[model samples]
Target: MNQPSTPASWRMWLASGQPRTLGIIAQTISTVISLMCALLFLAIAFGWYMDPLLALHLFLGAILCLAFIHRTGNPLGTKNMTFAGALLALLSIACCGYLVFEQGRLSERLPVLDPLTDLDLVVSVVLLILVLEATRRCIGMTLVVLVSVFLMYGIWGDQIDGPFYHRALSLEEMADHLVFTTEGLFGPALDVAALLVFVFVIFGALFDRFGGGNFFHDIAQSLVGNQHGAPAKVSVISSALYGSVSGSPTADVVTTGSFTIPLMVRDGFSKVRASAIEAAASTGGSLLPPVMGSAAFLMSDFTGIAYSEIIIAAVFPAVFYFFCVYMSVNNHAMRHNLGASNKNQLPRFWHVLRKDWAYLVPLITIIWAVLALNRPAFAAALACLGMLPVFLTKSQYRQGFFKNLIKGLAKGVERVILVGVACAAAGLVVGTLSMTDLTGKISSAMFALASGSYVLTIITAVAVIVILGMGMPVPAVYALSAVLAAPALIALGTDVLSAHLFIVYFCALSAITPPVAVAAFAAASISGSNPMVIAVTACRIGLIAFIIPLIFLIRPELLLQGSPTDIIATITSTLIGCWALSGVTEGYLLGHLSKASRWLLAILTALIFIANSWISLAIGLCTLIFIYARRHQAQR
Candidate 1:
């Protein structure tokens, strides 16, 4: 008997590496074909080819799904399973590719079950299966199960009795609506990813290639490396600068914490505390402006908010968050008397600026484009790439400029796989919610659960999303929150962007929450601290973020929603609240706090949030005086 034939996927995957010249030619051909198709859509779509445009978009989405599945590998099982997955992916692609090939030919009958072409329905069911399976392999069973539960709800919603139930969609109709319409797999959620995010990622990766991560660390260290508790402070500043762009908290922790954590350990921080500090600082990276990871991009699509407005609203909170971390690090240093070096021993701030100031141009230009020129996000990012060539003007980066540039672009495309996969999975959730009308149903139900009290409703929404956020990627959490928790809060009369951002803030914090904190776990690997311990410790050090959402919720002004005076007052009040809370929680302030002083600090924190303006300020004043007097007495 003839030997069993190996699958083509295995041959292609394996052969991709060998016969190097032929492989290069093949890859080049594939790239040309993809570009031609892309250009075709661009030309036609601009000329009002709506049906073909949408068909092409959907078609490309299917290809993306397949690519992600292949790249991520069939982690759930072996080669046999991987083969089965590739087969499903191809089938899904064929279904979509057919539409691209015959864009306007099947206009009326598309996705509807007819005697002639029930293939659309068949294709859709399989495609949904493939998406769920792909989600399982890439993300895990949690999101897959969540998507499945929603699928069931869309199918059998009418049969269920309750406010949550909606008239169920017919099987054919559900498949058609999901596969063919913009609301389903290729909806706004995916559009944001397809159009905007990958461009940003590629540009950022290139930016990183020229040594941006190290540059920021160098600047941060030179500025604060000799401060009391310099190591902890260094971790705070460097991680923030790096995380602001890198966006993956775990990756950020591993990259920066490897350096910062060891430095802190030598400087007298317990391994656990050092790890926790790095984990917490890196966890806040996604909240920083300019990138804020994929969440900000998704927010722009979900809330119909402008990217500039989103970044602006995030400014105070991000600053406050890092400031709080800085304070905690300072207290830890003072308590331990960690650093004794003066400014003379540290790198001159001006000297470091002179060296790395060139890298600042691209960052500043990107920001200026987004805010001042109001250029499109993708174009703004692409423009940043222009700076990469300029960096080669330096003698050091000159030798490997082309090589480093290629590596960055290739790595950027690889990174896109993970983000693209998450975005597509999120689209499925968005699709299901749209088809079932379950998003509105949940929003209404939440309003009832809180008895129509605005504060209660907001609190309930945050609580629910935070629980769901556990054990998930930041992108997944933010995506799920867009449809679930955010709608509820927005329904309760919250500012639209503020409400959306509140969900993001809480979801971002889950990276440091216990049980399955990704960032903390990464830090644990570096510091050898208990992951759980690091996670809990991160929560305390990160108390600033936990409180920020609540502040911005009640005072939308801080989200750039109100007059300048209102913004200033709320921000000042919030600053005082954070300072007091961090002092009490970390057990340090101007000096070691007595029990009475801790109580006083706790009371002041409550006053900032609950009391009237004058009263809160009065309390803030009193707290400031108390700190001054305590420090003075200690000196005596």
Candidate 2:
């Protein structure tokens, strides 16, 4: 008999496995590095620094091991590769280590009588670029390509033809950017990755391995598996639960999709519909609170707001998102005559709960810890370690618990590597902008374009964030956008949390935006649907993505920044908006809606529900009354 093939076998079959293990492992390490970076930042924030040398040693050791051990089949000779990898890894680690342990010591490395005398600057620049290359190898060519374009723009400013162009950088100046400064590789993106986002990423991974995600799935299945459009409802509940922890749409897709997609298909949903539902719902995870797609980290860091505030503010908008999705699926289910499978066929809720009851412990523990302590990073880290005991009690799984525990730890280490390195690389952009006062120039240019219209300025800013975000991953996108857009929002009178959340939402949702919808494309690939169709469907299903950002801007109370009364009013209004929008978009509220009615209802709902002002609400109410009158007249 033939033996079962491994992931390597499938890769060979597809002719695309060259970076499979390494890529996954690199991503995993990048997540952990992000967490550690955050911890170091917390230390800085709290005034307790880790030793620079120790942090450097820890980072370098992990990188060298991954680069050498995992890159064995690549072109480089083992010995040469080992030496180069170790050198680069150590250098990159040194940069972060210094930042964490020697917060004020970086000035010593700055150019003095001779700018070339800056040893730290030179080493860091070279190492940062090397890290960028590694990230490119692991993820894709897009980010590297985009960063390269920016670097080229920086250097060729004088030679450029466009009005926006500036003077080019000398090699030394480029080094100042790519290595020593905060803009290029160590900018806000890296700062968040290192200090805020990493812990959540680790929390996500641990949540999965410790059965948190599965627990969510089981609970969702039990709650809605017997309802009309049960599959889609499962998608809703499961996605929200998973989203709270996972923080990435694509990660949510793969996690929940592994089970939900097949189940949807089996239950009379088309491949396209099933994939679209999962894609849309999974994307919401980034918008969901707590972990919140790692955007919360960047938001807090960028706006100088507390993580708790961001979480609290985001709660209502996220609920609106899930509610819209839930309504969409339900309406479609009714319209199409879809219903739950035979009762006996559904998973036994009590049994599933009993079997997986313990999985809830970790998530509950993490939530309680975060709320009680008001420390998101430490809460996540502690939660990650705490999940292990729950796994050890099962005899069936206990034998390998220690091995898996080590593997999990190693996985954590590997997950953050690229993020760490990439942040260091991207810091070039930030460092250069700060050191040269280029960000101010760019900001001035943007403000110039606005001339005076705050709304246009906001629209223009959102456009910029979306465009830049197209090239970077979710975390990087949020980090970059928060820096550029948050200020614009603040200038427009948006509160701190609302402004940051607005940009962060757009950046995260950019994963499903057109032309570069990575998350949608990934799901489409699995569902074998046209990528564009998946993208459009995803955008439609996640309509809240487009509106929620605007709503928060319109009413900061939507993000829970106002008094209790205001908060209640904002949330109530938003839910009404969500339901009306859902009725409009999905073409159903109480029953099946005609195409004309759907269009009219959708418009009326948006106008009435979202326009929380009394005048708009009154108009919306009259419109709704007219619609009902028309429906009754038609029936008669």
Give the alpha-carbon lDDT of every model. Answer: 0.72, 0.67
TM values, all candidates? 0.86, 0.83
Model 1 stretches with alpha carbons more than 4 Å out = 1-96, 106-116, 340-346, 612-614
Q: Give lDDT tens digits, candidate 2, residues 1-636.
A: 988977765443322112333455445554465455444543543436764334443444345335433433233223223455445555556654554554455556654233654565666555656555565544445566656766666766668565555665677777655544444554566656655566666657655665667678778878888888898889889988887887778778877887888888887888878888888888888888888877787677766777877787788788888898898888788878788956676678898877776676667777787778787777777676667656765554477775655555555545555455445445555665554455666666678889958878888888988887763566777666666666766776777777778887888778778877877777777778876777788788888778888877887777766687766666765666677677777677666677888787767767754565554546555665765787677678
User: Could you give candidate 1's per-residue lDDT for residues 1-636 as a string of tens digits?
Assistant: 966656855543322111111245334433443344333333332342445346435535544543533443433223322454446556656766765665565555545454235776677777677666556555566676777788888887889887777875788787767767777776766666655665566666767778888877778878888779887888899889888877778778988999999988988899999999999999889899877867888888777778888998899999999998889888878877887446666677788777677787777777777788554453445445556644655666778776676566555654555566666677777888877788888888888889999878877887778777766767778888878888777766778888889888888998898776879989999988899999999999998888788777777777867787766777777788778787888788988988988898888788786664446667777777877888899889
Clashes of each: 0, 44
Question: Which has the greatest TM-score?
Answer: 1
